[model samples]
Target chain A: MYGIDSSPIRKAFELARTIENPINLSIGQPHFPCPPNIIDAMAEAAREGKTAYTLTGGIPELKEAMARKFLSENGIKYATPDRILVTSGISSALFLLFNALVNPDDECLVISPYFLMYPSMLKFYGAKVLTVKESFGTDDLNSFRKKKIKLIIFSNPSNPTGKVLSKEQLTALANLAEETGAYLISDEIYELFDYDKKFYSIGKDYDKTITLTGFSKTYNMTGLRLATILAPEEVIKALTTLQQYTVVCAPSVTQWAGIEALKTDMSSYIQDYREKRDFVYESLKDFYPLEKSGGAFYYFLKVPIQDEEFTKLAITSKKLILVPGFIFCENKDHVRLSFATEWDNLKRGMTALQELSKELAN
Target chain B: MYGIDSSPIRKAFELARTIENPINLSIGQPHFPCPPNIIDAMAEAAREGKTAYTLTGGIPELKEAMARKFLSENGIKYATPDRILVTSGISSALFLLFNALVNPDDECLVISPYFLMYPSMLKFYGAKVLTVKESFGTDDLNSFRKKKIKLIIFSNPSNPTGKVLSKEQLTALANLAEETGAYLISDEIYELFDYDKKFYSIGKDYDKTITLTGFSKTYNMTGLRLATILAPEEVIKALTTLQQYTVVCAPSVTQWAGIEALKTDMSSYIQDYREKRDFVYESLKDFYPLEKSGGAFYYFLKVPIQDEEFTKLAITSKKLILVPGFIFCENKDHVRLSFATEWDNLKRGMTALQELSKELAN
Candidate 1:
């Protein structure tokens, strides 16, 4: 009798799929095929006997590769293999981290216009959630100053909004967390997609910072179900014990593919995402109110009307699907449009959105 | 910084593996290759564009196949696609179920000498775990009736002890749950290894049972990371929402392979496990006092000396590894041995254990 407490993305998705002549655009999946080398690794692993359960932490090769990736690119230093735990995805990492950190009715703070799923994930575990109002690209450190929050989660390059945080903002947030004794869950899932600034990780400043990032956005291997939970040694041990009874380890074949992804030439794909990001930014000028996204695939638009209504109308008439901003937090007048699709689809979706805007204005 | 915890099977395993010429009697991994059909399917999926994020609930094909498999095997009536959530493994399913049902500090009743990881999983979620004493093959329904518990988890043909519940026992427990409003999480991971009786699912009588099982034991595909969560429609929806943000979905490659696992003939693998189960059941008879394990790939043996010390000594002297029983919530004098290794390894490990026992008697 759990009637659809339907997700905002799901609602928009359901409408788009069900409505005839639907131009589905609400989903956050990449349209590109997984790289051949990654897929080949998976196929090769299957042929070999790498089909047994791996250590709870992960296969050492994948963990070491991730560790090297962290060191060479970000200059983040951590103790060997023990500090990293491979998760099913960043989603799984959040679930596992919160389950380990938050007690029922414990206060967990999150930024406003957060990932729509945070409220539900925290609520499901009976965590008392408190949201601090935060605008994209703005330093919102003052918001956490007076709260009794046990944990706070935020995406570095904010999702949906696609606003990357400044270095000062990240340093301030890290310092605040160190002072307040609040564990910070920094979601760096979009680290590789930054448009303007170089990606900055908070792990360098605070050992308590639990970072969630994965191969989905960067490597475009979302379907492979690979991500890493990088934490301090103590936290990693706890996560390993927790994961042992949860997902065990991520799939062996997927891990093999992940290892290959870490070693491959990734600049081209990053460039591809940048191009798409720029194209969508340029096209949205006449269609809606927006700013160019700093990182990640989404373009959070301030729709001309209420998001719920705009989304419905767009699906039914324009045949274009965009997620309502209401799902992320409480930005009722905005919607999130993912530019991770093909250029043609983005073009078609934008055309439809423009028509819908004119009809709403009349 | 964290040393390995003393799990019943793990401790014995440490001892088993520690001996200079030690035999590894611990660890429950199968030596056989997973079905070639499953491997090929996974490779095929990886080759295609199926390596992106999937619906959190699962791929439609696998869910439908699981539904069919459940109906054909268990005669349990349920909706297929609508009622199933494919998880990374049963571990993920259990974690999700516990989080959904048990609030922090709320008492969750569990049978003793259960899976070693259960307490850790519960503690991670801040649940106050209480043990309701359960001995092998004993119907202790009355013990559970007196507690004001909110949830109870038990493995059928339980881990370490490998004790399966009878139809009457399962039915009685289901009725108890209905009476007390307590949820039941049936850890039926050993379903295919049942030797004494046909596996009787509690969900057959009770709609609220969240049954957890996977291919790790039956099909020897532990590393594949594929499992399904079968529940009433309501639980499925709640869990699906959790899974959506957590993993998005299990690995698409694993899903493809799982599709084949559901469709492929598993009788031969089941027969192989049975043979191994029988071999260990008989081999350990002259060595130590052991509980009768009718399912799972473990033999719960009562060591003559301190379980931990004996395990260490055996590993050093005999090259045999057996997991101590303390981790499984059993007496310290007991150890659990996995006979899931190759026949040669099993014979050698057992021989080492025998020699260590003789050496210890002096």
Candidate 2:
């Protein structure tokens, strides 16, 4: 009966509701609406009475589409439709995988500044979580090898810092997972948001890697809640069984829309996010200690004041909402600012953040 | 990591898929399409760009509507919007609640023949499950009192049995729960299908009751996957936090449709199910030992032979799929037959079942 506290990001959402016309840079989802064609497809599915439960894993059409997406795009030839288990979202896939694999007191390694759900869910299942910083090199492998880690997990084109891992880094991590007999879990929900076109799937090189990607972020259909997991057939079977008892299946109409989503090109949308990412990084780098975000629409800015204090001040003085970095990791000096808003709001939010930092420095 | 096997129901579905023209009496969901108006509302919501993640518990609109439904129809006065958690489905609601409440080796009581997930989920959380027969009298309370059961869960209009508990029976269970300090979870997903007009919610008389109901059965939207749990505010908060890390939120378009589902009248659909229930029961009662289902469009008929053997013969000889009772309970002398199909299918399926039973009896 251990209790889980609500995430601080939700508290930020609550705080934003109190502000009038807040320049909110705290959302993790795309600002754009889902494409019209995908929406129409979903509506058509409902109208055509495709509103009953699909099979436990998912409909064959969606799984086949995902299998092709994995092989052609991700370079993972082993991801046949049988190896893909469609889930409600990557969050649920992680939930199911963690439940299937992590036992009490099992050592699990998570890359630092991880997606908030990763640590929270692992701990919920009683895993002893060991976090390795995002900047870990090949030398980091030697230390973790002795721990016999059961699983290693991280989100690519990372959520808070938007730092995409290099191919060399991914290879080293995969090698480490192999040495330690640990399953690698790659959360590639931000795959399509890679501004530098440098995104690589660890699953392409590793047999034990569990790759999770979904339609939510790429298509701006987060509410539809559909995702796919490419894994070993044994893993897929276990997760599908878990899904049958948990989520049952992903939403049927949304699964239908996912077929259309795979067909809809998102290059223009990705281009817009790339421009926004560049704008946010360029505008803030001189004012604050920041790294250029290579992918995803976020800039983790190191603020002059405490992250929480600075966030509060920004909301109070400038009506801006930013997520304090403590919720994502142990870095209280950094605050995560999502550039996934309108161009006007992004500019206003960035300017407000600059003015607040100047005031705090003075 | 304990492995969970796929349920027998899924195996039945897989077997049904292999047959050319299977009469799927084993299917748990309604055969009817979702109402056109509800489907239209879902489509309209998607078209309106309501396709982003909602608040963890659910949208305020749906929760408010659920609160109204609970208060007016269920006589649950304390179920304000804040006390309700919208989940992917009742299965997910059960998952979250079980994760939140059940500790390792905790004692849990389930009334048998229970929904398969009840025992499986409880055991997944390491509960020592105690089953009280469905025909348990008030005297049965004395035996369970000493067991120190932490929770008691059962579906009203029970999934396998379809036997709606009398008000006295519900009161006795509630009183037993009160005396033992155990939380009572009343899954009322089939509340609308109470053919006897004898449905009663324990939440009306008990403070510790958690009432779960959903639109899946009433609106014929099993694939849309939306349900609500009316519980204490503290319990709701915990489940909501868990949901945020798991399913994230119920599908957004479906949540909008839920508001419409609440408004649409479903009496005609319930009447249709009632008639179908009568048709199936009357047709088979003389041939087989059957209890007329009081709710939820199912009959648990005592079979003339072993449950599995009878189910196999029916499927082989008659292209009929009936669920063996062993999946739902310890009894092997019974099978569950759903009467949720069309009039033609129900009639044909009933005749086939009757012939199969006679052949087996001979």
Candidate 3:
């Protein structure tokens, strides 16, 4: 279990923190501060001494707000807070859901270019991850009918690739899940980051779908450690059972911050990320075979050399940090460049990437 | 499994929350504010935008502070941050440590009346819990020497019982672990609540011991969701690997608060709880077969009737909430009353308890 390389991102993050004037494109942290209102809400909650454990599932107010969000944003109506489980983060939400749904030797499906934690958490629970050689939005599970996947965990508005699932794709996924009696677990943390297409959640159509999203990227509050899981009532109950032994609840003060965060407008941050996505595409589009970033602030840039070599070069020579795509997927042909840092840092990172690409060409 | 009745305390908490002026002694929350410095530190952290994910183990500042604490307070010298892991809470810390240490069907020893989550989490991991019918401080491990126990998990300055482990008991356990190649996990979350005892952590003597403690009880900041594990370097490394996928890291803002919390004086709060423990023991001693309160704010009071029935009667008739001892142990003969509420509420809860005892006797 400890064999998994959980260190690359952390290593890069650590290296970035130490180097002077280094451009850190390795992590997907929001450039802006946590919304002032939400931060104030947390401070206010602490001042009010709201520092005791909430119910194992979550605070009622945060769950209620999250239910409201599920109805308005995703068209999925959770009539009450019973179906929502506030998690420490999307990371922990996935951990609990996998532990709740998975058993030893259970076959779970994952799409290629998946998040690292998906396989790691599944493996921790003694479940096997069978990867489908399909893109995030366009999943082809017909061949895997014999595999009998108990659950399918994949990301929408994909990390590393920034691919958003189409509504039709989500509909197909919901239909397949219902047909196969397998649950579709969608992680939509990047829903608010989508630029080209409307964000679609399979949970809208599939009762078995569990959509995980959080305040991490949307409010630039990853450190606040608040996330939401909207699932079938039974699934939520099961997850809460595991969480009672895990977190008890998301931090109470942060849940209060989440209550306020749901009320704050994020149009400005959304528009700004859309602009940066466009800028990153235009800047590196010429030399690197970078995909159009539809949602998340990342481009899985196909490097001229092996991703590991280029990442090392970028770190040592150009003082730029990028994650090798092998951590995200089976292939090591690409390095993920994140444009979620400050404008100055992103610009400097782009220059380093361009230099690395030029040097590799010679 | 979701079959476990996880809602007894929550049910009482919900009931208590709804009724105006209800005396709630159900949850183990401290009836005090977080130290002012820690609260200010958290607010300051948010203002400074320290809301991004830190290293998976913890922020370096917090880990360093914890290492310092291990040496100064516990007299166990970590000498480096590598041996300390900052977790979301003692709850999450246990979840990670068990994931890292306990294997499926491993024989783990638990002292009777162990913290509820220990067996729950161990069971979640498919480990068998072997209860040693002994008090927290005194254990007879001679019979268990032949049983190949992989680990021993128990609480010191225990929650329901408020029993502080003696130095000789810790030394014997440590020696047993060393001799048998079994690990000793000492949960010292209640370390600060000890009334007339000097808390002696097993890790001070045994390197094979992993000592778990946290800021939640010590600083009256359970909502902060911060804790520490001082363990062997290898165990810390393994747990860090799991935490990367579990919580990612303890919340960065709270870690800042923890840094300040490490420096704040907890003498006043400790003294306050000590006095409350005394007040509670004095008031309830003649009525219930209550032991003299030693540590923590709880007393495992023997009831005249079955604890569950008496608990229900108190809640329904007197608008008081208390936890039955069966939640902590196999017996239904006792109820656990917490003196961690405000003095007025605690006094009221005591009155309710006295009345319930009289009524039950009749």
DockQ, each predicted model: 0.51, 0.75, 0.74
Clashing pairs in 3: none
What's the TM-score of each model vs. the native?
A: 0.89, 0.97, 0.95
Candidate 3, residue B194: Cα displacement in angstroms equals: 1.7
> What is the C-alpha lDDT profile of model 1 across A1-362, one tens digit per residue?
13226566766665666777666777776667778988888888878978887767788998898888878876678735778899877877887787678877888878777887677878866788887665533345666667667787888787878878777767777776776788888898888778776568888667678888788877777877789988888888887766766777888878888898887886776677788888877777776777788888888888887888887788766778888888787669988888877777878987787777677778
Superior candidate under DockQ, 2 versus 3: 2
DockQ of 2: 0.75
Candidate 1 per-residue lDDT, tens place, B1-362, comes to: 02225234433433444445556767776667887888888888877778777777888988888888777777667646788888888877876787666667877777888786677767756777877665423355666566677887888878877777778777777877877778888888788777766678887777788777687767678888778888888888888876776667777788888878777776776677678777776776777776567777777788888788876776666666667677887478887787777778887877777676676677
Q: Pick the candidate with the highest lDDT.
A: 2
Q: How closely does chain A match the true chain A in each prediction, as TM-score?
A: 0.93, 0.98, 0.95
Clashing pairs in 2: none
What local lDDT score does residue B216 receive in model 1, on the 0 to 100 scale? 73
Candidates by lDDT, descending order: 2, 3, 1
| CAPRI classification of candidate 1 | medium
Those runs of model 2 whose alpha carbons end farther than 4 Å from true positions after fitting are: A1-3, B1-3
